[model samples]
Target: MLEVVAVCDAILHSPWLLPVLVVLIAIDGPFPVLPSETLLMSAASVAFGTHNALAVTGLFVAALIGSVAGDFLVFGLGRSSHRVLARATECEGGLSSWVRRHLLLRPGTVLVGARFVPGGRLVSTAAAGRFGLDVPRFLVGSVASSAAWSVYMLLIGLLLGPITGGSPLLSLLAGAVMAVLTAGLFALVQRVRAYRARRALAAAQHPTEPPLVLVAPR
Candidate 1:
């Protein structure tokens, strides 16, 4: 653990960290396991103390660009799977059924909000591509979300500096813990929602018959 912390501290203090941020953000676009937010926060804390505002701004821009590229790549992959997804949508089962039951009819809402929600981000993007969303529209929504996410992380990092005593490592760790908790909470909510949805479907399909009316004999 000490070695890891030392390594993290070294990296946080390194000049090369900015490029590393770009690659991490790219990976994070499709995979939630990567803590891109934490990285940005850490970099921001360092920049705050060093008075390197340009680094902070550059990091945000790099992250945003990487995210946009990553989302587009995943969206393209999803488009390639269009035939399979279409078949699944027709079957009224699995993720397709859940999406149809829960999500709005308009694809734009899904495209815009997916990037804000955990798990939903990449999945919804892929779904949009699979559903034949216009490439231009999809790119527009993706750019918007990526920009918002980048700015949010940068600000969070800057704000966290004072809170963590300008310790970039601690701030990064806290952000990572928060991300993990957020993901866990999302998973729990999804499980409960899925259970409720399944129960409702079952009740609708096989509702208990009303108690038989007993004829009173005079």
Candidate 2:
């Protein structure tokens, strides 16, 4: 663990930080394994220790570009797989239908919200492409979400900086834990909403029967 921490610290201070950040975050788009959120935040936390404001700016730029590029890649993949969506859907109102309906109704919402959710970025971006969200709109959403994600991550790091003394490993662990909790909360909220929607649909389809009125004497 100590050795790993030393390595993380070394990498954080390495000259190749920016390039590595770009690569990691870019791949992070399609693959959740390297989403780079915690790494970015840990870097920001180091920024406080290093007291280099310029580094933070550069980090934000790299993260923003990388994440957007990653999302674009996924979007392209989805676009390329038009045949899959071309087939008839199995259900009229399950996840696929819900995604399509929301993407149509609120593309920005879907794109932006998905960025913060674990594994959501790829799914939403792919859905957008598969469902025919145009390039321009996708670009707008990608940029918006990336920028927002970058800012949010920096703030988390900054907030955790004081406690960790800006230690890279500590910050990384803290950021990862925070992100996991946040992602879990987000997933829970979404699940609750879906459950409610399902319940409403079921009720509408088959409402409960009213109490029987036996008024034979009347």
Name the regions of candidate 1 deviating beyond 4 angstroms. Answer: 1-4, 45-56, 82-105, 155-159, 208-218
| Tens digit of per-residue lDDT, candidate 1, span 1-218 | 56756766777878778777778777775565775666676777667656678887888788888888777776776778856434534455444554455433655565555555575566766676666778777777788878877777777666666767767667667666666776688778768878998999999999899999999999
- Determine which window of 10 residues in candidate 2 has minimal summed lDDT: 85-94
What local distance difference test score does each model get? 0.69, 0.78
- For all predictions, the C-alpha RMSD in Å is 4.2, 3.3
lDDT of 2 by residue, 64-133 (tens): 9898888888888787874543332223544446556788678888778767766667677888877788
Q: Which predicted model would earn the best lDDT?
A: 2
lDDT of 2 at 4: 53
Question: What lDDT is reached at residue 216 by model 1?
Answer: 100
